[model samples]
Target: MTVINVNESNFKQQVLDADVPVLVDFWAEWCGPCRAMAPVLEDYANDHAGKVVIAKLNVDENPNLAGQYRITSIPALKLFSKGEVAAEVIGARPKAQLEKDLAGHVA
Candidate 1:
């Protein structure tokens, strides 16, 4: 499945209200690290479809979300479970590490 574009408008239903856990990628268009991790996120989304909700929040377009989560850096990966943040990773990392970081939630 393609990644969900989570904004203030549908953030609730897409993330908070979902039955499955959510992987929210907080990124902006100009961030190098964020761009680098895009494909890795997509592959994970495809691999984990139906089991988890993969969402992307553009920090440039949705500053409120970034600020609300206190996302001080680009490429902030946050995992949401049952309406609250379950885990997180900052900066770009290998797919194995990303999966390992979220093993409890996704595996």
Candidate 2:
């Protein structure tokens, strides 16, 4: 499964009100780190599709949602559970680290 593309219009319903846990990646086209995290995120999307919902939000195209989320950094990863934010990662960390961080929700 591929990660869902999140935008200002879908932010509320997609992440905030998700029935399952959500991993939202805030990224931008010009951001190197953001680009770097894409493949890892894609792997997670495929590996944990049914278990959790993964989304990618482009900060450049959707600044409204990014600003609302206070995403000052590109490639920021936020975990949402039960309609609220549960955890956050603020850099281009390794996939192993990401998995370790979201272990509780996915596993």
Cα lDDT computed for each candidate against the true fold = 0.90, 0.85
Model 1: lDDT equals: 0.90
Q: What's model 2's TM-score?
A: 0.91
Candidate 2, 30-83: lDDT as tens digits = 889888998998888888878788898888898787887898877899988987
Q: TM-score winner among the candidates?
A: 1
For each candidate, give its TM-score against the true structure: 0.95, 0.91
Segments of candidate 2 deviating more than 4 angstroms = none
Q: What is the lDDT of candidate 2?
A: 0.85
- The residue-by-residue lDDT of candidate 1 on 1-107, one tens digit each, is 85888998999899989899999999998899999999999888888888887899999898888899999988999999999999999999988888898897885
For this target, which candidate reaches the highest lDDT against the unseen true structure?
Answer: 1
Count of backbone clashes for each model? 0, 0
